[model samples]
Target: MTQSIFDKFQYYANLREDVARLDTNPFNVVVEQVLSETEAIVNGRRTILAGTNNYLGLTFDPRCIAAGRKALEEEGTGTTGSRMANGTYAGHLALERELADFFGLPSSIVFSTGYIANLGILSTIPGPSDVVLLDADSHASIYDGCRLGSAEVIRFRHNDPGDLDKRLKRLGTKAESALIVVEGIYSMIGDQAPLQEIVEVKRRHGAYLLVDEAHSLGVLGEHGRGLVEQAGVQEDVDFIVGTFSKSLGAIGGFCVSKWKELENVRYAMRPYIFTASSSPSIIASTRVALHILREQGAELRKRLWDNAHRLYLGLRELDFKLGPESSPVVAITLGESKEQALEIWHDLLDKGVYVNLVMPPASPGAGCLLRCSLSSAHSAVQIDAIIDAFRSLRNNILES
Candidate 1:
């Protein structure tokens, strides 16, 4: 029998079969309505939203909504073209300038997404001879960026500065040509990188460092500049990549750097050049969000961290195994089997709470995890409800 192109999808079919057997599909939950940044209607019930990446709870900010609405009325919907053509608008240029100013970087390049920011910069900066040392537990976009680049790729131990130093030393004179990539806060585990140590290592080897603050911006630092500023190593980082989706409450990505060569990336980077520019509404809303991130970010951060600590302590009291600490992302170890994790996840949803269900390969350490992200908008009542809900479901989850 001749094989069809769709034959390769057997793996997906098998996974679906397992899901059907469990009578619980974590990936198939539907959101019927979004009541606020922290509440939603799901499965015909009002559900507390903790699965989303709405860190600052700016999704429902009146200023952002007003900006977007104004942009829609004045600037129309989309640009209808790429930045290289008719897509480049005054608003885009203005937003880029605001971002550059916010980071105190000499140059900034805006992309269609945080993912594309990595892809564009990674593929364009290093040529065929250069090398990239990436953390083994990096995000998918970071890995994809390395694959797209022409450089030789090497994986190092996650958050281990000594291992990175050794890898660079092994490269001899080529160490200076290497790009050491790390994230401000790893997405899956909700843990942070050892930035100060990594910075020292990079300085010792005379190598450049790129920090992805995708999950850290507006969630860290004094005024929400991310881990770079939090660690007092902002001056040491070469390229800083971040997404507006997480904290800025919009859809876009940007790379900021002191090196003036960054602006030239738009010419050679395929992802930046080929894709249509962000919509005017997005640009407008993002601009407002960025302002909020700067002006009133500290208050929001305090509230978010307070909520995080409350939940972290609450879960610990229940004897649940948790991740590193009280981070914006709190992941509970749900055991090692996919079935066990899925069953618990379905139970949580049935209890009127929603969270992310992580499994092996995609999740670090190949463990099943129930991940929740804390938002500034989460109420004290909601936090208590989440904790109580988890406590009540303990027996059911363990099947005890």
Candidate 2:
């Protein structure tokens, strides 16, 4: 008997059937209308968007809109070619320069999305002779990138610098030239990596370091440069990969480096070579959004942190299991019970709030996660309303 290729999806198909029987689907949520930065019409009802990773909430910013509109009108829709071809618009080069300037780095490469940035760099930089050491709980993009490369890949315990040191020691001479990858702030649990400690481990091992600041950009540091600037280890970090989708409220990713040799990697990266470049509108809006993040980021960070703390503290008072620290991403851990998690997630949405529902394989552990990412644009009343919704759940089903 031969196995069908469709046999692989049986488990997921069964899981989908189970969710469908519940009369609600967490994965198929549709926004009927985007009411504001914090509110949207979903399931034919007004819903508070607590799950969106819009850290700085510049999606509705007039300045960004105007810039995008101007670019759309003048440059038309898209570049319609790869960066090495007709896609390399004036805006693309200008944005790359601006990004390098923002990070105080010498060179930068822009990709269409954050996932591609990781894929292009991770797959291209480390060769067959090199080794890639990453956190065990890294995002799927990181894992896929390593698989795409010829380098030997190893996983260290998540955020465990000691484990990283041990692995590097085991590699002997190869450790010196290895690449160590970690995120500034992990997406799942909203916990930040101990960059100062990780940097020390990298230095001790003589390895190159790459920090993905996708979730931390515009959320950390005095100037919102992410954990690198906050830990004062910018000079030690070899590469800083980040996305404009979060804080900048645009769809693009970039990798900025102090080493001039990164400029040479552009030619070797297949992901960069084959993929179409970002549209002029995206680059223009991203540039304007980056400017906003630089100039007015302090106030925005304060508000964002305030909302994060407010949500964290409120959930803690209700005795719900949460991530270790209070950050923009607040995850409520529901132990290994998909049914209960699904119930709670559906309830929250029905109560006029929408959050991310993460399950096993995707979540960090055996548990499921009801992750809520707060936005700077969310008002105090909106925060309280979200809390109130959770409180109602605890009272109605959780506590009982």
1-400 per-residue lDDT for model 2 (tens digits): 8999999999899889779965558988888899999999998899999999999999999999999999999999999999989999999999999889988999999999999999999999999999999999898989998998899999999999999999999999999999999998999999989889999999998999999999999999999999999999999999999998899998989999999999999989998889999999999999999999999999999999999999999999999889999999999888687878888899999999999999989999998899999999999999999999999898533432
Q: Write the per-residue lDDT of candidate 1 for residues 12-102, one digit (tens) a residue.
A: 7877877896544777877889899999988788899988889999998999999999999999999988889898889889988999999
- Model 1 Cα shift for residue 115 (angstroms): 0.9
- Considering summed lDDT, which 10 consecutive residues are worst modelled in model 1? 391-400
Q: What is the TM-score of each candidate against the true structure?
A: 0.97, 0.98
Candidate of highest TM-score: 2
- lDDT of candidate model 2 versus the reference: 0.93
Superposition TM-score, candidate 1 onto the true structure: 0.97
Clashes of each: 0, 0
